[model samples]
Every structure is written in C-alpha cells, then in structure tokens.
Target: MDETAHALGASRTLWELVGRRAGLTPDRPVLLQGDRTLTFGELRDGAERAAAGLYGMGVRPGSVVAWQLPTRIETVLLSFALARLGAVQSPVIPFYRDREVGFALRESRADFFAVPGTWRGHDHTAMAERLGARGVFEVYGTLPDGNPGVLPPPPADGTAVRWIYWTSGTTSDPKGVLHTDRSLIAGGSCLAHALQLTSDDVGSMAFPFAHIGGPDYLVMLLLYGFPAVLFEQFAMETALPEYRRHGVTVAGGSTAFYSMFLTEQRKVPGQRLVPTLRLLAGGGAPKPPEVYHAVVREMGVQLTHGYGMTEVPMITMGAPDDTAENLATTEGRPPAGMEIRIVDPEGKPLPAGADGEVRLRGEAVCQGYADPAHAADVFDADGFLITGDVGHLRETGHLVLTGRMKDIIIRKGENISAKEIEDLLHQHPAVADAAVIGLPDPERGERVCAVVERRPGTDDLTLTSMSAFLRGEGLSVHKLPEQLEVVDALPRNDALRKVLKYRLRELYG
Candidate 1:
C-alpha cells in the first residue's frame, strides 16, 4: 500500500479520520451547499455539539437511531454526530414511505427516529407519528445542540456494526444490511484510489444522503481534504449553475446522471454542460458501452463507471488512467484487497472469462444483515458473500456483469424488486398474473416493464391506470412501471410454473 492508503487503513473509526483531516486542513471547505460552507474544523465542532445534544436526548453509545433526511448540511452533521457518539444509525431514503420505513424501524429496533417535518409536499414527521415511531424528532433547519463537554469519548473499535443499510428486498420486505466504520472507510479508500482524486479536485453529491454512496463519497472528501457541492434535489438545469459555481471537477451519480448531463450538453450541440467537469464517475447501475462513448465524444469528459451495491458501497471502479476499451466494455477492476470469485451454481470456482455468479470478500464488504435468517443465507462456507449478480472476470481482471440471479430491476441506479411490484399487481382485480422485467434503456440504463395477464371478460388496463393504482398502493414513484403490456398468460416453466423473467426480457427488451 502507498503512504496515503496505509494511513487511511490505520483509521480506527470514522470520527478519528474526521479529526485527523480537520487537524491537517482546519480551514479547508469540506461541504458546500448554496450560500453555506462547512470547513473540516467547523464540521468537527458542529458535530461535537450535535453529539452532546444527542447524548442529552438519552442516545448512549450503541443506541439505535434512525434518520430519514435529505441531502443537506444538517444531515451530514447529524450523521457525523451519531458517529461521534458511537450510536448505531439506520438511514432511510427520503423517498421511502410506510412500507419501507416501517420495516426499517422495526428491524433495526431504532430507539429514536429523526425526520424532516415537511419536505417536497410530504410530511415525514406525520408519517413517523402514524407509524408510532419511538422518540420521533424533526431535524430540518436546525439540529439539536449542546456543550461539547457533555459528549462521551469517540468510539475506539471500528469493527463493531454502526450502520444498517437497506437493500430493496426481492421479496416484500427490505434487508437491513449491517456495516461498520472500517468497512465504510475501506470502501471509500478503494474509490479514492481508483479515481486518482486529489485535494485540489472539487466534487458533487447529486444522490440521496441516505444512500450508501453518501458515506462512501464523504469519506473521500475527508481523506483527500477537498470540498463537494450538495444537491438536496438534483435537477440538471438547477444543478448546472451550482456545479459551475463550485467549479466541480468530478460529477456523476450513476448512468442516469451521465445521460442527464449528456442530454443537457446536446441541447446546444457543442457546448459542455459543466466546463470545469473533467471526469464523470459513478457505479450503481449498468453503464452501456454507448453511454461511455457518447459522454467522451460529446460532453468532452472522461467517463468511468464501476460496480457496487448496498451491501458493498464500492467493489470495482474504472480508474481514470485505464485503457478506453477496458473502461467501455468492463466495470473496471477491483482494488488490491478485494477478492472477486466467479462460481457456478454449486459454488465451484469458474475459470477467468467464464460467466457465473459473482461472490466477493473484502474489508469493504458488509459483515451481514441485521436478521440472522437473512445473514445465514447470504454468506457461503468460505465467508464470501454471494452477491446474486452474474458476472465474469476478464483475463485482465476487469469485471463484466452479465445478468442477475434474482429478479431485481435496477432503474437509474435504484434497485426495484420485480417480485414486490408483481405482488402488488396481483392484487389488482383485473390482473390474473403479472411479471415485471427490466428492459435495456439507454437513458435510464434499465426501465421497468410490466407484462400482465388480464382476467377473463375484464376491461383492458392502461399504463396510466396501472401507474395510478401503484401510486395509490404507496409504492415509491421511481419503482412504478414505465411500460405496460397485456398478454393472455405469462411464460412459465412447466415444472413449478415460475415466471421466466429472462424470457420476458428477451421478448420485450
């Protein structure tokens, strides 16, 4: 390991890393949102106060606190405060509702739940109350504050679980994936090293603060001593000015983000969307080869996509110095300590260049899920986590994902379980059977397509009405089906009558 990597590896906890960075560059701006700026020193100070306040609220070390907030300065402070207090935190996506949020709170056994009062026309505080959430509190414009002297000493162990991230379950409920400070730090280290970033580079966070990528990105800034612009709600037009204003050198959330930037750049034909942007890097959804070519040719920027999931924030990332062919065709390469194994159905390792289930083991990998039943099924005998993703390692060590072992559709980097939507569709009176599949979409990377078999003598269901029905069922807007197709019956295997989603994709894709 290099000197920087060695130092990062030595970080015992996230709070320790933050303190080191603050001491190194006290006045360096670490976060920029609108007219507000938070330097490394200021971040430490504010978090200490917040930590004291949280301590006053009966949140002791190892207390389970859950928060559902947007990407704001206050959110960052609250997260860091939790870290400083050594509290186990579960962050829910701001868009999640009763179905997801309720499950998270119950599973995590959150002692306290923090929320924004009312945001984007939704009342999160009211929703928390409706769920009878314990210790519900609002944290929008201001967070709790108290004297730093009341705060307890920072956590010493990094291996203990401090984070619970949710993965959109293939079934009805989401899995609470467990992670520790060391795992998050290791994930960030892989990204920082792979991207070849420096303290001089300015970054942007367009994704949700509750997403796994949030901590992963924040660790990069803390490690490199750089600043990043925060977008509470990222719209291309509104975010463009901020990017230019901050002189962002690195920007992108996922394939969708790259497409959004390219769409804006194509509006005027030869003008760059953000002139200061040199590298567009992200990795939640699959990136088509064409998207890479388009971004480089039209936007005049280098595009580097990687492979990651909620369980592991980052596994493999395309470096800025990698060959164009490798960057375009593969999902880059895993860092030195990460072990990627391609195995057959029986868990036998496969040869290079052969497609199989992708299993990973590394310091960045999450230890397990909160539920023991779920944990028992995910990890193998060798301790490698079975990723449920089908991919192969090239002779050059690049990972090329082919498909998934589960029926999960990744639309714009968000995992939408096909089974969840299918179960809801089955509830509709006019639907006899339903199968949801992700079709290849250049703009979204994958668009959700629902194919249903109508009940006998019932009126045909339109896409608009189906969407409205899903909305009424409290499904997140992003998970709604973008396309609808009616058929007599869904293709199924003869033995168990299981819907063959791959066949649906083959027919509709």
Candidate 2:
C-alpha cells in the first residue's frame, strides 16, 4: 500500500480528498471528456468557484439540492461543488422522467434542482417546471461560478448524510438511501484496492454520473491519481474513439456494457477492439459466466464483475488477480472492512456454502433510507443490512449470488420492479390476475415477462398489445415486458393467496 494514498483516503470529507489529491498531483489529468481535460488542480479550483456561486445563490450547509444531469465534466464539477458546501445532494438518473423525478424531489425535499435544459431532444427544464420543481436552473455548457473567497468553510464532518440515492421501488415509491462522504470513500476504496490500479491505468465512465458508481469510480481516480474518460452518451462506435484517444486501460459498467463491447469486438474477428484496453470490469448486474469467458477469450482482457446496490455502492469486487474460476462464477470477496453474512429465513447466521439471504455490515453501507419507516424494515436486529439478495459465501471467501428476495427484475443493469408492472397489468380490463417475473436472457441479463390470467370472455392478449398498454400507462420503455403469457390462472401459495413468482419463473424460465 502507498502510504500517501492511504493517508489521503483517510481524509474526512470528499472535499478534503479533493484538496489532498490536487495538492499531490495538481498537474495530473483527473477527468477527460472529448478534447477537454480537467486536471486535479482544476477540479479543486473549479469546484471551489462553483461552490462559491452556489453559496451566492443561498445554498448553505445541509441545503437539499437535486440534479438530473448527464455524464459530463460540468456535472462532476457541480456535484463536487455541492460537496464543498456540505449540501445534501440528490442525483436523479438522466433517463428518469416526471414519475421518478417527482418522487425523488418530493422525498428528498430538494430546495434546488439543476437540469441541463433541452438535452438530447428532451426538454428537462420544461419538464422540471411542469413537475413544479424548486430552484430549477440550467447547468449545461456553463455552470455557476463565483469567487472562492466568498464561500464558507468546507464541511469538517464526513459522517453527515450528504447524499440521498434512490432505489428502484419494487412495490412502492423509490426509497431515498442516505449516504455520507465516508461511506462513498469506503465503497470506492474497495473498488480501487480490488482492481489493483496504478496512476498509469486510464479508466472510463460509460455510465451515468448520477449513478452510485460515479462517486465510487471518482474515488478510485482520486486515490490512485489516474485520469478517466467521461462519456456523456455511450455507444460502441463513438465511445471507442474516446477510449482509444485516452488509452483507457479499464472499461465496462455492467453485464450490458460487457455485451456491448463484445458485440463491437465481434464486428471484426481476430482483432483487438481497443489496443490499450486490458480489463472489462463492472457490477450492478449479474455477469453470466459465458460472458466472462467470451470477453477473456475474444477481447483478450480480464473481466471481473462484482455485487453492489444503492444502499451499499460496493459490497464486494472481484480482484484482477483472482482465479479465473472464481472470477467467472462468484461475485468476488469483500474487502477487509466489509462483513458478509449468509442468514436463514429467521435471520440466523448460516455456515459457509449454505445458500441463504445475503446480509452485509460495513462502513461502505449507507446510513439508511431517508424514510425512517423503510429504514426500519431494511436493517436486521444486529444492524446488518438485509440486502434482499440470496447468496452463499464460499469457504474461499467469495460470494455466489443465487437469487433475490426482492420483487425486482434487473434488466441490462437497470432495476425494473415487477410489482410495479404487475400493478399496471392488473389495471388492464382483459387481465383477471397478473404476475411479473424475470426470465433468464442471454443479452439482457434478464428480460421482463408478464404472465397474466385473462378475464372470462377475453382472449388474444399478445406481448405487443400488453407492451402498448403498459406504455400508455406511463411505464418506462425499459420496464415494458418483452414477453407475455396469457394463462388460465397464476400459481399461488397455500397461504395469503400471494402469487408465486418463483413458480412463474420455473414455468416460463
């Protein structure tokens, strides 16, 4: 371990880490977007100016500010500015519309909301106005700037809840998961340590900056003093050039990203997609073993996947040096500070190799959800977070995720709540009962499948029609079911008349 890197990681707050990294490597490039680059020193200076501007606009410590911006250099600057002010910030996914955006703003009680105006043909500012969002401001091309001297002292405490991240609601509204600077740092530390990166290793952020992985990846850059290319909109052809230009040594966001790269790699057989690329690493969705083997075989790069969520940005990550079998099959091992426990239905600890619920306890875990009632249900008696994921720990310390207890489907690395779709399906006049389950998919990781019981005298409910109905109900395009099955009745357990989703999976998987 580098002593200076270790000391810098011990910084109290995100702003502190920024300052320390800037001091250590002021001239080293930290963020690269297109032809532009922001050095570590520029990151610190720009954030301070933005913070001053935010302060001039009346943003103070603990002020709730929300942003729905793309993965851009300005977005990173704005977020760090919020950190500099100790403002509680909420980041909404760029693709999320009025439904999710409204919920997040209302739940976080955001006093201010920053948007990119009209972006990619979507009128974000107009939509913000339509949603009656507070403090709506445009932050594209240019950002708020003022004298750094006008700003108040940076936040001293790193333990304060400064971030509210939303989880895709399974049966209800999205839950606001609270996080602190320390937690974010801890999560990023795990990722940096596991990857064994050096200052020379270039990375790429193909995912949304609003995603939890944003801070987690940034922390790695800060720790190792390496630069990363940012992609505002990532596609194989367009993104490849940026990766090549920046010489991105590490890339990938999830299983979907892996497949995308693989598809691009297949465009021309017996050729490397990017000469400098060496590793394809990501989490947030299950990485099929075959995908791992394919990437290693064809792309000639190490592919390491991990397990993470909104509550805990990084619980475990596959190390680059791990055994190929472990890398392909397991979600890797937790770092020194993380504790992974397999528990029975009653919450008793299960021995290694026993498949059970996956529970986690670590500094990286978020403080809890903003809603106290929801938080109460998520944490176990011993303060371990009940992840709602079913997995078993190997004696070798790696974790094997089997399934999830939550009624949510992960499709192409995005969480789509089955209950949300099922509720919508129940509203259809032709549907007497509905159950939504995720079926194994080669390309998508999992594809949403709706199995419905048709009402008496109703027939001819097709997948296309069902999807159209869902779209009419305001469901996101990603959440629309790709496969539909009209059945006589749904399988129900003997108790409580609950639809057995596992049975549906068995029948349709």
Candidate 3:
C-alpha cells in the first residue's frame, strides 16, 4: 500500500490525484454516510459537474470561495469541485461564531461564501448576511449544477497557494495559514504511510471536514482505496451504533477520542467496545503515556498517536510495529522527506536527548502564513518553521514532546514543565482531567496552579490530597502546584477537544 501511495504521490495536483484514483477504482466506494455511499467514479463525474456549476456562478480559476458546512457528502463534492476549478478555498469550522467567522472572511478577502442556512439550530445564512459577506449563498440540500463543457482546464501547478487554514486563535485573532496542493498531498501521504492501512480496512472521520485534517484524511482514502464513515456530529452514545454497523476498523481523532472509547469499554468490562475496531489513531494534542497504556490494556486495541499542527499537518507518526515502550512514550519517527531539528533558545542545534524547541523543514510544511507579517517570527535564519513546541529527540529517532515553550512555569527563578505535573495529576484516580498553568504571583515570579476536573463519584479531591499524591509520585517540591481549583469540566475547543490553557489562565489568574 505504501509503495502504491508513493507512486501515486507523484501526481502534481489534487485534481490529478482524484482523477487517477477514480480511473483505477471507479466502482469502489469512497465515502459512506448514513444510507448513502459515493463511489470513485461518481466523485469524479459529480465534481466536474459541480465545478462547471461553480464556474457558471462566476467561480473561475483562482477565485476565492469560503465555505462553512458540516461533514456531508455534498460538502466533499463542493470541495473537490473547488479543486477542479483551481479556486482558492477558506474552510471555516461550522461551529465558529461571529468573531472568528468575521475575522476569517475579512482576512481571506473571500469573493464568494457558501453556508448551510440553518444547521443545528443556527442560522448561518443570516449570520453571513449580518457579516456582509460577498456572494453569500446557501448549499443545504442542493448544490449548483451546470454543463461540464463550460468549465476550463483544471489547475496544473500544485505549488500555488490555494488553501487558507486558520489557527485556533484562543488568545487573539486567528492567523491565516497558507497551504498548497503538493504540501497537503505530502502530509496525507506521510500519515497514510505511517498508519499502514489497506483497502480492506474501514475508517471513520468523526472530526469536522473543514479542518486541515479533512484533506489529510481524504487524500489517505484516495491513496488507499478504502471507505470511511462520516459523522456529522460525534458523540459516544450516538456514534457507537454507526461504528458497529459499518464495522469500523480504524477509529479515533485525538487523546479525548481515545478516552471516550475507553470510557465506553469500561461499561462492559472484558468485552471489545467495537468488535471490529483494531486500531485507534490520532494527533493534535499531547497524549499522556498513561492514556496510551490504558487504551491498549482496557480496550484491547492498538493506539498509534502522531504529532501534527495546522502549519505542518504530519510531522512524526507512530507505526504499528514500533516497540511498546516507544509507542507509549515517543511520538514515533518522521517519514523520509520530513526533517526534525532540535535547537536551544539561541537557535543553536541541540544534541540528541536535550530539551529544546522542535523545528521542522519538509515538503509537508506550509509555505507561510497568509499574511506575511504573522510569519516574521515563525521561521528562523535556517528557514525551518519554528514550532513553539518543546521536546527532545531520542537516539532511536523518536520524538517526545514535553510542553509548549510559553507553557513552562517559572517559580523563584526555577523553570517547571507544566506537562510534568499534568501527567502525574492524570495518574490520580480521582482526577478525570487536568491543566497546569503559571499564575501571576507577587512574591514569586510565577506560581504553578493546577486546575482539574474531578472524576465522577470522587468528591474528596482537595488541594491537600492532590499535593500529597504528587509528592508521592516523585514530583519536585517547587514544581508542585501551589494553588488548586476544581471545575466541572476543563474548557476545550470544538475540534480535537484540546484543553484551552489560555482560557484557564484568564479565568484563574
């Protein structure tokens, strides 16, 4: 499968890849949603007609079109249609509200906007009108259609910037991240190669299709010639039936996803949750080693977690054949073309096993931010993307991330890794989730504070007990959380469910 993917990876643009895959397996199923299935041939033909329709609607080559839609078969067709027309697309998450949506529309200077009207009880069309977005249109149950003869030739250059992905923007306005067709293809190839998937295996996409991971996963399907179930809204109670019905083999989106599956498995101990599930794989946030071990032991499934960001979708990914220790501890090895370099604060190269910033230079990395001003400090003199993540590389070529550069907590002139404390806190049976942040303190430079969500039926989780538990786990005295606050649930984003540390800081500071 990897060899085939490598050969197919030679295609220049995404449209070419789509056409090639459709030619190879025209009758094979590509996407599965509810009772509807879309085949490879239908995808090619449908996208062409859709592209002609969009062209008829004034969407020509290089036209900027922004769409905010849910994960549906129509959404996939529209995206590929845009690809067929060589139009620049800015996909906003369906859950984004006025501030984020307005910012994206203004920043991308989108010529046209597509909305779903009223989805999940929200009036998206009304919101678009309120924002004064140009060329506003709704694509709920129907799409634009026209004769295919009117469309021009597809895009030939894959290197041109044709995608604009926004950062989470938890702290401020989101920056538009620029990506190309070749870069997205490289990222998906790296991920598909790492997962070791086959056409016989079934997959699932529980996350939003608007995310950068959307194209990453789509490319994987085209390369491997497999079908994946699409969940418009993901929840354990409602999603389990689909998993069982489709016999999903590969499932997961991030650490939260792994935990959700584990929580379900615990209800019926000693029995597989989704009898067909063989692997749980994802990346986007840190994975506590304990979570990995828990999934492997409790769910009886292999969990392969990778490291990725919007700027560079796939950095390092765990393989199925990796050692148990490495799989549980490290983020696996990078593929052939991806380069991982560790550097100190001064930008000097750091030796293996030394903690430093993780820098990347590879085909999968984005060209740069949409606004060049946001990219000034993003790249260093060596031209590697300066990822704000802090980690070290083992001699065995595995990367282990500790925490974020700005996430480090300093106390009395000593630096403390928040992840170190958070990881230990997760081990406590009473804690369901945790986030450690540095709070402002007058006496000390900064104080370590631990905000945690208590596990159900465990109400005795006080600060004193938490401190004693940490000390017993061999945590340093100074690194111990000075203040402890309990919340019903930790604040998280809609995508990946990554804990919003900045939100925690703002609330508890």
Q: Which candidate number maximizes TM-score?
A: 1
Q: Relative to the unseen true structure, what is the C-alpha lDDT of residue 368 in candidate 2, on a scale of 0 to 100? A: 87
Candidate 2 residue-wise lDDT, 151-214, digit = tens: 8899999999999988785664788999999999999988998888898999999989999999
Candidate 1 vs 3: which has more lDDT: 1
- The model with the greater TM-score, 1 or 3, is 1
lDDT of 1: 0.93
lDDT for residue 188 in candidate 3, whole number 0-100: 94
Runs in model 3 deviating more than 4 A are: 169-171, 406-509
In order, the Cα lDDT scores of the candidates are: 0.93, 0.91, 0.87
Q: Could you report the Cα RMSD, in angstroms, for every candidate shown?
A: 1.1, 1.4, 10.7
Can you write out model 1's per-residue Cα lDDT over 1-509, one digit (the tens) per residue?
34764585569999999998888899999999999999999999999999999999899999999999999999999999999999999999999998899999999999999999999999999999999899999998999999999777899999999999998867777899999999999999989989988888999999999999999999999888899999999999999999999999999989999999988898988887788999999988989999999999999899999999999999999999999999999999999889999999999999999999999999999989998988667889998989999989999999999999877888888898888998999999999999988998988889999999999989989999999999899898989999999999899999999888778888999
lDDT of 3 at 397: 90
TM-score of each: 0.98, 0.97, 0.82
In model 1, where do residues sit more than 4 Å from their true spots?
A: 1-6
After superposing candidate 2 on the true structure, give the runs of residues whose Cα lies further than 4 Å from its correct spot: none
Please give the ranking of all candidate structures by TM-score, highest first, separated by commas: 1, 2, 3
